[model samples]
Target: MLIPYGTYNDDIRADIRAFGELLDKQAEAEAWIKQFDEKAASAREKIKTAVKDGETVGIYELRSQEFYVLGDNWGRGGQVIYNALKLTPPPAVKEVVDANTPPKLISQEVLPQFAADHMFVTTYETKQEDKDKFFGNAVYKNLPAVKNNHIYEMTFEQMYYYDPLAIEGQLDLVVEQLLAHQAK
Candidate 1:
């Protein structure tokens, strides 16, 4: 089974075990997949409602070539925080993928179609450099989040670890940033 990223725990182990059991049962496997889809849709609704009444957030990953959006199904810490805060992610990212699978890379051509009030960028290296690149780009300057200076930098390694301590740390960082931005 393909997952976007790794989350080491018994729950994943159990999923693996179940995957093995359902391997030969095509109907069962498809049924399980359906369940995942339903759950993801439900999560998106809850987040949307939250964003309607709470804060607006956009979770993004910057790669060398393409922009990636962290959607409701990624199972990353950003998704967790977004869900908790009831913040809806960019709706353009409609695909519901497994938590372990990588998000779809969006083309630069469609950049204008995406918008958010506040942006969280996942920086893999040189956080300032990544932030600087985004800030310097003319294509992104018109974005409300960028125009309002609401862009935030973070690292996936710091935010995506599925450990309890890691989640707590990510939660604190996400909430702190949101609160800070909301105040302004």
Candidate 2:
């Protein structure tokens, strides 16, 4: 199940409830509500269409196998992948493994195998040196991703800690790197 790890405001929930109420055929305003739903659906489709054009998108995270489904507001990485898939000439997407997952923690492994084809690592400043040291060592040299030089690193502050408004900027960097290194 997809879980939202962030805050949820009452106003958003209220808005959603109100929208649902409008869907009731028994309501006297059903006709207008239907029109609204149609319009809203059309707008959503437009956004999806825009995404299909190679627009850089961002979300919090993604599930292991279903890249298209996204968590409400917390799946920043998932949003980006969904958008990429909507593209006419879709950009290559790599599944984002949760850093806190047991398997990922135990073996320091990213999953789905294909994700390793173009892996990106983002970490805090305090951990950057250690991460760099470890990945730079000979032991890391034997890993498939590292051996092929497919792993790229970026700062967590740049990718995740900054203002939410900056997520698109981070995604631009990710898209560029993925496009450049996709085949290699």
Candidate 3:
């Protein structure tokens, strides 16, 4: 069972192997992360105030049907909108997760236990047909975002980068889509 990067296969044996000392060293890194959590949390509160309170936002990686949350103990460029908008991210799961990791993949055969008020589906491919197939898949079509018609397609270039400019772009795109969805 070879699970590709950025994708998880439930049928495959879980890779729960230990990282030993490297894992232990993360404690020092976590301390640094804690310093910025305050700012991110504050930004989140303001974003929530602007939008309907308690509405969740999630970015669904279309290539693998995985959901990207603010993983680990740090905030990254890709999560700026979610933090600024204070959208409720998927509930944090307690596990040994690495930073900047790919999302938690949900099997295509199973309905996601989590849903979002606005779901952004992103992929590296540019073809609409490819996107259509992914979004049209059974489990994806049944997601609350798809069912509510709040699903928005985002290109890989728009959502995949983590540099300052890319972060700004992602934030802008998110605002535009969310506003459009709100209008609809």
Candidate 4:
């Protein structure tokens, strides 16, 4: 999904809640819900505008096939595309295979099955190394996304967890990258 670059606090909070539920961590989920609600209450108007602006956003859950929300830097430009779409109206949430389903080792054959229209954010020691590792292999070449050059790379530090605002800031950069790719 494509979304504009912006903060989707509500969506983020929901994800936190869903994450807690996925792990059966009710306490953590409740805490996240409370925090998110407080934040939303304080900025309802801003969020409403974000939803209407048609920003590109993408949402996905960890170890799940479903995409959740498109704001913040948890993923790549897909999040931005998702955020833009959120402004207009929310989309139906779909369930993807999660860790609860089963554990399948990720490999070259498995990789193509996960290829998406937009690439998810990932990192390596360096840009060239990342390309060599992911793009340099024959198995990876079979993936449609790989062939289309839809993958993105970032530093591990950028992908690490942080406060909501910090995450949003990083997402802005991700949006910029997405726009750049579109221009190219």
Output the worst ten-in-a-row residue range by lDDT, candidate 4: 93-102
Q: How far is candidate 4 from the true structure (C-alpha RMSD, Å)?
A: 11.2
lDDT of 4: 0.42
Q: Write model 3 residue lDDT over 1-184, tens digit each, in one string.
A: 3434433211011111111123564554444345445545654454443356666566655453343433322223234544434455544322212234556565555436555666666664346676566667887777777777677777766666543345445666666676677666
lDDT (tens digit, per residue) of candidate 4 on 29-131: 7876576455434443433432224322222222222112223333433223333222221222111221112212344455444444444444433445554
Candidate 2: stretches off by over 4 Å: 1-78, 82-104, 108-115, 127-129, 161-164, 182-184
Off by over 4 Å in 4: 1-11, 14-105, 124-133
What global local distance difference test value does model 3 have? 0.50
How high is the CA lDDT of each candidate model? Answer: 0.57, 0.37, 0.50, 0.42
Q: Which of the numbered candidates is closest to the native, going by highest lDDT?
A: 1
- What's the true lDDT of residue 47 in model 1? 40
The candidate, 2 or 4, that scores higher on lDDT is: 4
lDDT of 1 by residue, 2-88 (tens): 643443332322343455465765566556545544554555554442234544566677766457776643535554444434455
TM-score of the candidate numbered 4?
A: 0.45
Provide C-alpha RMSD values for all models, in order: 8.0, 10.6, 9.3, 11.2
Arranged by TM-score with the best first, the candidates are 1, 3, 4, 2
Greater-lDDT candidate between 1 and 2: 1
